[model samples]
Target: MNPVHDHRRLGRELDLFDTDPLMGAGLPYWLPDGAVVRHVLEEYVREVERAAGYRHVYSPVLGKRELYEISGHWDHYSDDMFPPMRLGGGEGEEVVLRPSLCPHHALIYRSRSHSYRELPLRIAELGGMYRSELSGVLGGLTRVRSIQLNDAHIFCTLEQVVEEARAALGLIRRAYDDLGIRASRYRLSLPGDGDGKYVPEPELWRRATALLEEVLDGVEYESVEGEAAFYGPKIDVQITDPAGRESTLSTVQIDFHQPERFDLHYIGPDGGKHRPVMVHRSIIGSVERLVAHLVEAHGGAFPVWLAPVQLVVLPVGDGQEERAHDVVRRAEARGVRAELSGPGHGTLGARVRAARLVPYQAVIGEREADAGCAAVRLRDGRRPGAVPVDELLERIGARDSDRGTELWAAA
Candidate 1:
């Protein structure tokens, strides 16, 4: 049940995800199926974030070295970032690849001003983030030096902090439940009182931490010390795969500190300029890492909605190839990602075996072509059933809405 190893092997076996040390460790390639699976997740995140009032924004991949300096990453994680280089001529300024989605997002907020009514502003970005993760620590898609973050930043007034946190936690829960992954733990991460340098504002830390704790009351969680973000306490969800490996998939972080460092402010109803509290979050944290998790969690038999090929239409003989092709077109036209498989040089038995490898196989032949029906054999074979194209389309539509369900449709 080593998910890391399981995905590493399953990815290659399914011709989905790939990694090569020569190209540098931690950077994995998403083959056709892997890419499709990831695309589905990305689309899902985009829809959810948009509905949550998150405005999408794009920024440069590289930023001035001073950006990291102002964000304090230079001192905390400088070594974990790409080396900086001078841009333009030698006398020009230096720039480094952005390792996280925050510093740039902070700049986005700093780029504008707003009133108290607009205090709870959310900005989302599905952009690639770069980090200099040690090659030794690299593993398939689970750990990557370069990854895409389905990230968002929330800005709200002090009074709205708890509500904001609650909304974020709910979002994470929705994603976990939809994906069929067990909700391992949704906890309030607070710094230990023992940590000497934890904000000198003990009252602020106490009130903030307690607010988060109160929100989790009656909710499931087990607190852990020293796991809170250095900037603020947070609500984080950790997922435990079937193999028992734990990973943090999403978080709603309370940052009472970064806003000040970045000098972010908003106009209050009192006609006074007030600093807004900022919360950083990522529901699909790192898309690459989450894809890796899903690969192992479902053992490469992706749910119909997330499966790269929802159905592979196979011709029973050379004579039925065109009919199989027609079935493929019909499926794809219905917005189902499907393909046609041939008997090839192998016997019909071999072709059927290969077809089973796909999540769903449509065996089209005299029976299927004449009746205009498909033998929709599921990958696991636990649920074998025939579904007309329209029926399958209806099933696909039902799975598209993730609310309170897993990302991959239930088998």
Candidate 2:
């Protein structure tokens, strides 16, 4: 792998994001450019979830200590959690930043009684989660203390487990297909024997493992023992990056313990109350990590749709400045993320070099301005003569709408 294309280097070169000593390590703040990329990715994922029948919700980031205690995280995963803060006076309660969003979703499921018809209720949130990770292990976006998870929970009856799991896997596959990501392999992570961290119910563990196995049948996976989460068994989709390093990018977990521990239930067809199963899944894993992967994968040359600035308009001289600004306004009016750069800022060659990574660049010179058109330059070193303003708008808008990787071919 070329070090120049590494996410850390590209992040600096492109002014994507940064970490400061005063703000602490493992916590990154996104710059304006980085924020645009994040917003685009986030909105895309939200649309995917909406099509999958997920109801989005927002909950408080801090929860009472009793919440984790009841969910068993306080006893099993307290070390990964931040210290609880006491609120109010002597009889005040202690609340801590949430390490995960599962416990909160479970409470949402219980807020109102659900019937058998509402068997497969999916709740999703792109919420912030904090983990007290070791500073030594912290690096660029991949290992961070403050993270945003594309998390969701599906509450359904026992008979619906396989279907829900299949739907979740389909969602992951569709997302990866759209982004051109391929999973290297799949692993069925199971609990190990004599682990004090895991719940000690052998019957529950066996049933959950069996259900997951049924869900993953004929799906080409390796069964790995001792890698399951404390609450249940899971299927992890692993992807190998361009650097030959492997990481889990998506996961589907069948959790039977949490629903029981929290007494989550729904009315069945026979008019009897029955416990509902919960499936925890994340399609993109962490938003920060996904952005890092894409940065390295594309060498900071994002697809036209995902690029922070899809088009950069450069005025060749002072006389063309007004035309350049007008072109920018036209692009923006048509929903394109466009910016104007003047010759005052830098030489024409210098400005073009700086915007070399952008998918499309437009040079508005004297003749082109007089003719009301742009001399379009593509990232692939192709200048396709002067394109009329209306045609330029249509081509760029089509590429953005189609999420094409290259402007010339897309046009």
Candidate 3:
């Protein structure tokens, strides 16, 4: 991998995130710039989910140990889960950092009675979960202990499972397109033969696998064994990093085991109770992993809408500082993530270099500032040149709103 394209190195150079030896491995803290990027991306996800009929929900990161046991995580996935923490005394109540969000989501669905009208209840959350990855294999945000997953669960009748799963895949594709991500391939992740890691219900496994296959009817995918979740089969959207290492970035999983274990059901048209199928889908698996792939893929040059500092106002000299500040203020009022880089930072060239990865660089000088305009430079080395402040903002706003890759809109 090119050092410039490595997220670990780019993270340090870009002041995005950092890991502390004292804080332990696989745990990293986001710097201000990085936080901005994360906040924007998270908002983007929420917007997408909202438009897709997913109701947002909040759940605690820690759950009773019994919760996972009931969800089959404790039995089938405890090796990757944190050790249970007992409260009060050894025999007292035990809790653990959740390894996945589905268990809590299952509890939420069970919290209320539902009719067939709300059969396909989609619940979404940008929530945190933890993994107990060994230190030796941990590196940067790619393999983090704490993860903010773009997770959602759909509870629907068995008949609605295929359509819901198909819609979830469509959502993933839409999100990937907007984020400038290209999936390497689709994978039909199935349980391996005689794998104790999977749930013992052969019927549930077969049914879930068949449903996923139906969901992927026209899509190209490779069926791989031992990659399925313990509860069921899944469609894993894989992406390759700059280093050529492949990883799952997004997924749509059909879980029959959870609904059975949790005894979840809904009132059907026949006025009788029926089991609701659970579909687990993640548009962007983990925020950390997604950002890591983004950093490497874009080489720290994020799309304008996702850029930490969308635009930087650089004053060519001391005379233009006030004008530059005005430009930043106006940009901020318009919700653009703009900042001012003054002469005190060093020469104009140095300031530009510092913000090289920023989407838009607006350079102000005596001439342009006097004329109430700024010379515009794009991160991709396009010099649109001397666009009026209002016009510049309006153009950028259009691009941002569209989530387009173009730095400037067409005339």
Candidate 4:
């Protein structure tokens, strides 16, 4: 990647995140600006999930070793997982940092009995998980040991699996459009012949793979072998970075193995217990990788709604300092992220250049301050002339709410 477009470079320059040698590789800490961006994205995903009938829940990051044993992680995926830590000297219970959220979610579903009335129970969480990634392959946020996953699992009957998966794919597409992410293609990742990474169940694998195919009906996708999950097959949404590297950014999977291993079931109308299918979905994968892609995609200039410092108020001279401060206050009152760049910083032009990535800039001078207006400068270098404080705030709010790429509303 070019230094100008690399997320690692931009992250350092924009004060997004950084890694400390003491903290170990693949572990990066977010700065204030980065935290704001992450917080906004998290809230946005939660709102989308809630509106789509998904119930949010919280789960711990650590799980008992036996949990993964039952969920097949220990048997099939222990290498990529951290070694279990013994609580006591040597004979105490062992716990592990989970490599995936599914096992814990499975436990949550089994906490109580369910009926067919809640067949399509969609559960969502923005949770943390850990991976034992090799240091040689770790770079930036794209490959990290700790991950905050935008993950969900749906427990539904056999009949509801197709529709649920379809809805998940639609949600992913909608989110990408709003986030300014373009997917390269859809990949149907199937298990390769004699691949031991997959669970050892031919009939179960066949059923799961067929069901995913049914869900992908009419969707343009490429079938690739050896990319399926250990427990099931999945549809991977692939994307390319500015550096020409391709990776999966979103995914949908159908797993019958975990449901069977965990003995998950729902009561049918006939009063008989029936096994429920598990559909795994992620709208934007991990928060770290998503932000990395976003940083490179936008070159640190985020959309207005997602930008850390959305608006910066600049005073042309000392005489307009009070006016600039008032503008900042008004913008903040209206729920816009606003800051002030005083004349002491530098020339108005220099200050503007420094904050070039900011979405909006409000420059207050003597004439504009007298008229209770400010010269509006957009990040894209378009001047909207002098706009009244109320009108300026309204326009910014409108663009932000719409999540559109356009800085100003159409006339």
Candidate number with the higher TM-score (1 or 2): 2
TM-score of each: 0.91, 0.96, 0.98, 0.98
Question: What TM-score quantifies how close candidate 4 is to the native fold?
Answer: 0.98
lDDT (Cα, tens digit) per residue for candidate 1, span 1-411: 764448878788888877766876777777887888888898888988889888999988899999888876776667778999997889999999998878888889989888998879998999987989876887778778888998888988989888887888788878776776766777677777634435555666676688788778789788887777655677778877667878787887777667878999999989999988887888878988788888877777666677777777777888888888887777777787887778784776676676565666677777777777776665666444565756765565565533322322555
Cα RMSD (Å) between model 4 and the true structure? 1.0
Q: List the global CA lDDT of all models.
A: 0.77, 0.89, 0.93, 0.93
Q: Can you list the residue pairs that collide in candidate 2? A: none
lDDT of 2 by residue, 85-139 (tens): 9899667999999999999999999999999898799999999999999989888
Among all windows of ten consecutive residues in candidate 2, which has the lowest summed lDDT?
A: 402-411
Q: How many backbone clashes does candidate 1 have?
A: 7
lDDT of 2: 0.89
What candidate 2 gets wrong by more than 4 Å, as runs, is 89-91
Question: Candidate 1, 138: how far from true, in Å?
Answer: 1.4
TM-score of 3: 0.98
After superposition, candidate 3 runs with Cα above 4 Å error: none
Write model 3 residue lDDT over 166-284, tens digit each, in one string.
Answer: 99999899999999989999999998873579888989988998999999999899999889888888999999998899999999999989999999999999999999999999998
